[model samples]
Target: MTTGLLNKSTSLDMKHLTVFIYLLLSFSTPLALASEKKNILVFFIDDLRPELGCYGQDYINSPNIDALASDGVLFNRAYCQQAICAPSRASMMAGQHPDTLGIYDLTSPLRRTIPDSMTMPRYFFENGYETLSFGKVYHHHTDDREYWTDLPDVPGELYANPRSLESIALLKTQAKTRGVKGVALGRAARGPAFEAADVEDDAYRDCAVANQAINALQRSKDKLFFMCVGFAKPHLPFSAPQRYWDLYRREQFIVPERKLPQGAPLLAFTSWGELRLYQGIPQEGPLSDEQTQELMHGYAACVSFADAQVGKVMAELDRLGLRDNTIVVLWGDHGYKLGEYGLWCKHTNLELDTRVPLILSAPGFAKGERTEALVEMVDVFPTLVKLTGGDIPESCEGTSLEPVLKDPGEATRPYALSQYPRGTKMGYSLRTDGWRYTEWVNIENKKIIARELYDHRDSQESSRNLVELPEYADLVSTLSKQLDTHQRTAARKVKAGQ
Candidate 1:
């Protein structure tokens, strides 16, 4: 009887051991998968518009960006909060709106506005990710240095052409004659608008930025990283390699009609004083046809040059074997005008300036898909957090775009809002899937000064203002109410600091 009891007891113990082993594997398998967090690679291109070959512009040579779009979901209607570099970038990085931060110009540092606010990079850093910025992640390089794991080493040789250097020398000499000196002198002296030198890509700053970013990727393959590689090209001076310029013919470029939208208020237009700073551009009247065509060609060439840099960085990411577990996002700070509506640069609340190119390529998301869903720059913060399995902060004003990434047919927001400030007046523009409506309001009085409504169903460009047309009165009223409601709600959120 004692021997039989011993055998029975041993069988019971074995059964218990087998059940425990099965339970342990079931629990640990998911835990191991959860622990494998994906890395983030962000490309911040300055003053770029959605005019690449991926966006159906066959004339533009952007193979790298097009390939990126093919590998991910391309957002067809991504709008910036503000159309300028500083405010737009600040809004994006802070995960807040420009109105929330009260930043409308290039000079204001975001830290001054919200000292304790958690930036996207800082959020990643706090969550045990190595965050690094390779180039102009912020409008000013020194703006948010403390938040980054490390900033890229200072680059060399902004311009390579001898004539471009000569123009800078001339501008400095002219400024010195007026008693300008120090930083003020440096600011006053500007270079030519366009340069295409017969030199290597490293002769410009963007190539160096890509090189540094590749080095960062090599060292970061083992760790989860939030790497931001910003490319400063297709921006002012439009300096690029001669080979890139040779990709396009100046005569074949299609120049827009050199006129503002009919029935649009003068306040809706900019003096385009930004373009006048360059040596070749005319200070006052419209550019001649030849000059316009050449500028177009230069812009296109710079776009191609920037695209090549993107290819180099992405190649390194692939070679490092990080592509499978990495999330890649490429976007511009804001859209460029490219002589659209006779405008030369960003700073308007128009579609050409506010709309940006946004692409997201990640493992397990919808691949080779295009989504017409409206997304804003602010939404990027929460989306990244969600993708990385981190908790989105309560202060984040934008919604997570994970669902849209999963199914390209999903709609996250009804419309995207963008704003720009002009002196005492501020323009708030609302873009829906079919139309765009804008209202310019006086800041002090809070009175609506002017309004603009453009029907974008027919064409992307705004040919005329339709706000006063009797047929669209109800639509205008509806959009106006929506804008008011959103602004009021956003204001309350900002005041509460949520």
Candidate 2:
């Protein structure tokens, strides 16, 4: 019988042999076993929103990401804990909410804030997996360097156009004439807000990130590796190759109607200082129609450009024959507002800012499914831990999403939560089955100062605030109580060191 089995195995092709090995390693074997551990590939996109073709947006050219969604479970209502890059990434990495991490701004050092916290990379490393990160895993490149097996390389220039650099130099020279010097001059000398350069995809920084990630995949194919490849396009300045830009017509882009939400507090809107830092954007006012169209066009082009990079790395993963036993997760750090409600960036507690794109594909799970289940970014850590057959930590505030991965229709939680800070006030927003309720409270006293209630069943965007209306009063009261209870429970868990 042994001789006959060996003779039959000799006739198997390479693909069949690989599948046999994968199935042998996968079936009835836990990921805790060192010899049979699966690989992890994570794509962390900077400032990416759910404007892809898979998310039902017809205009965006995202064939690669859409293909990923077809093979994975796409979370329709996934959200980040905070909209900003630093807090959202840190919260997801630490498997906690922004409130637990105590990190809200880009300047706050992660190690100093939570020195003993078990980060995702560190936890995986301790579980006998080789971990690697490339390009903008954290907002700062140097952050949590001690956790990874290898240090990530620093990314290249933001813009590759010679004219863009010349424009910055001109601005700097002009600033010198006005007596601005040193760091201030550099701050004042920004390039164009958007550029469509006639160059290859590799001319931009994200392509290099993709190339390095492909190389890493080639080198680490035989090992149990957890690798993160982050892309920095569609984030700022909106620079991309002309080929991607030529994929769309400028006239197809619609400028969002510039209007403030009715009854919203002054703090509910952002100044969009991030946009104003560019060369042509005005200091204060609605952007002109032409400028808005160009910015939107550039953003769409960058999305397609980033999608191409994703395709490269994913293709490499397949070529290396690692797809069957590997777990793949693609997510945006946070969503971005292209011009919704006249907002340009993600600093508010609005749905456009907090709702992110989350896709996960793993072995022995449902494929090509879209789930409306509400999941938070903080849940990623615990879910991965559970998928690896490890016990979740008691201190994790997020629930494991393993059940949802198995069955796309499973509901993991009642609602999704997000927060944003402005001056001395903190806004806590909750998204339930049909409504979004937000309350801005004084940070010191925790006294509610402003409230916003949007009925998602009626409008996609928050057209008007209905917190003070007589009809929705009872609903607002119920949601507010739920929010209070949720916060209190989280606080109690932290206090007890759970």
Off by over 4 Å in 2: 1-36, 181-183
Q: What tens-digit string does per-residue lDDT give for candidate 1 at 342-444?
A: 7789888888899899999989898989999999999999999899888899878888999999999999999999999999999999999899999999999
Which ten contiguous residues of candidate 1 have the minimum total lDDT?
Answer: 150-159
How do the predictions measure up, each by TM-score? 0.95, 0.92
Worst 10 contiguous positions by lDDT, candidate 2 = 28-37
Screening candidate 1 with a backbone cut-off below 3 angstroms (N, C-alpha, C), the clashing residue pairs are none
lDDT of 2: 0.88
Write down the lDDT of every candidate, Cα atoms only: 0.90, 0.88
Question: Residue 322 deviation, candidate 1, in Å?
Answer: 0.3
Q: Pick the candidate with the highest lDDT.
A: 1
Q: For model 1, what is the alpha-carbon lDDT of residue 468? A: 94
